[model samples]
Target: MGAKDGRKGDPEGFGPIEDQFQAIFDDFFRRPVAGSGRDRRIPMLVSLEEAASGASKVIKATFEAHCTDCKGSGVLLGGPPVFACSVCGGKRHVLQERTLTVKVPAGIDDGQVLRLAGQGDEAPLGGGQRGDLMIEVIVAPHPRLRRAGVDLFVEVRIDAETARRGGRVNVPVLDGERRIVVPAGTVSGAEMRLAGFGAVRLGAEAVPIPAEVTAAPYRSRSVGDHRGDQIVTFVVGESSTDGQDDTSEGRRAARNQGLWRTGVLAVALVAAVIGAFVLGR
Candidate 1:
């Protein structure tokens, strides 16, 4: 018998018989009303150089109402048998744009997050917490500058002549160009210190390095001095010299010629002495 009939024994002949059961549950209890969900969002980012934003400037951020066409939903709405989801208004989450002034604290490391309080959208259901918006201050890498911890490192290539001769070398500093004295006999790879030549320190309130010369001594020793190291790889001349045998008569002749010239020089000296004696008499 059909579900409406009272007969109980395998009426449809599909499976084992069972006692009467309660399988029907109402679907209307789960449908949500309009404005039921808390706020949900996706954000956009804009990055501009610090100098680009002039003084006395303010940036405003705002959110738009959900689109009525697609109802803030991006998807194409409406089909015959199956209908589109109405909650996203056919557009997914409604937009809730917000704005906050991003403070770039000095000496903040790259990728560090700055939290904006109460700036994010509200939670969808139950009036839960608003989402947190994090802003990161990125100091773009300088093409010429290399940074360490509080220490900033810079490399300069000095010619061997200048190093050996010892003279003034120009080094770049944070604010301006500086002249540093490179000692005489300074070898390549020698690191000389120009004090106070580093990046901005975050908290400690003091000028970093005083104007003082830090000599990185070389491993080369000349009796007594502090020494580090400078690896100097020499390029040897591979072209060989032509062979000359000492026993060859040509060399003997050359030697004999030199002896003969010395003999002539001696004779001239003797004559000069004799002439001096005659003049004295």
Candidate 2:
């Protein structure tokens, strides 16, 4: 024989080996590999009350997804010209809009991030894996309340009479109004604690306190799990107006006082007119 026409055990002359190599190469390219796509980060703004109590928010985001027309291959299949896909322009992925509902956990702090897996860009070239979406939580500043860690701080303005007589004063809480006791002889800048009424601790199970349980003592002890206390700073007289106008009752009281003063002035004017007329007679 001039030369061996084929290998000793192969009669088909490398056809099967070529087919096997081609199959392996196709499989390798089709499978998802690392570094296929990029993760995306977005900022989510939420209110302090929503962060404290946890809330569900709808968000609209743009992400890269596999091109449906070309099946993410970047090129048109079964084409004699072998041209790039018109839809994706050979990028293999297209930008698409997605609406997602995000669940913000209770006690989530500002600048914290929430990761959602497989919500970012899809892998290129029809790869299966997808990147993650990072949601950075941005907590808006509260008007009457401030937060430090899990503790909540608020300035409460009380009348001089309530401070002297030791009465119940309404304090602002996350859920609603909470009445806190003002001790006799309480002075301005006095700090009081409402236990188990602050922001929920991270990773701690907590439920919203009932609205009926309004009265919380100044030095109340902690009663539940995964909760921080609300710190109340008292301000007497007209020194501050941080939390005074937050309550409707305060507004109503001010209105009533104004009306009473106006009525007294009218009565005094009428009495003066009558006295002048009687003196003339």
Candidate 3:
């Protein structure tokens, strides 16, 4: 029998109810699929100070978007049955360049990911939605400082005399240079803490602490303005003054001369007193 000569009662063209049900069941049991467009990761390099203090950055990238002519439909506007779009060539998406100004929050650690919603490529077939753009932050290495969690570590080089006598050294911070006092007899790699002078965490405000108040041993803590500490590691350095006169050295020399004169005068007085006593005897 020919293929077209099938009997009406025994149909071979249409599938059985069981087969139809099986097909439906297989379709329903299929695994869920993710979105078509892929997410993009961009590396952003920022200075340590900038990471401490929140800053803004402008990002420029090329992404896929729905064609303006097709309006994401992949069809032309001319007829009842739509025609393929000439501009996008039925792809419905076009390559586009966009710029976004992203605000980088404070205390954003290295390798941290920042997500920008709907900033990635558009769906390929017929645009429905877009993916996200992820920004990975990278903190650049500093010459004299490093960060651990929220705390900042700075290596300060000071003269041996200054380290022994507890003098001040200029330390660099986010805002500016601060004169940090090195305790007397401080050794190499000794860390000194500067409260409220470290990196600012995210969502924390920068408060202006008064000098007198900071100097006070007992000060009340405020809310919503938490600041980390700066660790100043002292490195004993030598004075390299060949021709220029160091003020500290000059003062020390003058003080030594004065002490010598005083000692000589005291000895002469004692000798005179002994001579008088001997003559009286």
Range of the 10 consecutive residues with the lowest summed lDDT in candidate 1: 19-28
Top candidate by TM-score: 2
Candidate 3 backbone collisions, by pair = none
Residues 86-203 of candidate 3: C-alpha lDDT, one tens digit per residue: 6655445567788888888877878888998877776544344577899999999977678897778887777777667655556776676665555668788887766766677667
Residue-by-residue lDDT tens digits, candidate 2, 1-281: 11122325556566433443343356346545644655889999999988887889999999878778878665667786666565665556678899999999988999999999988877765566678899999999998889998889998988775566555667788877876566767798998877677888877876665353445443334435777778899988743343333343544556778999999999999999999999989
TM-scores for candidates 1 onward, in order: 0.42, 0.66, 0.64
Global Cα lDDT for candidate 1: 0.41
Better of 2 and 3 by TM-score: 2
Model 2 residue 187 CA deviation (Å) reads 1.5
Ranking by TM-score: 2, 3, 1
Between prediction 2 and prediction 3, which has the larger lDDT? 2
Estimate, for each residue in 72-156, the C-alpha lDDT of model 1 and write its tens digit: 2323366433332343333334455554455443344555565665455433332445544555445466544455554455555
lDDT for each candidate structure: 0.41, 0.73, 0.64
In Å, residue 230's CA in model 3 sits off its true spot by 0.7
Write out the backbone clash pairs for model 2.
none
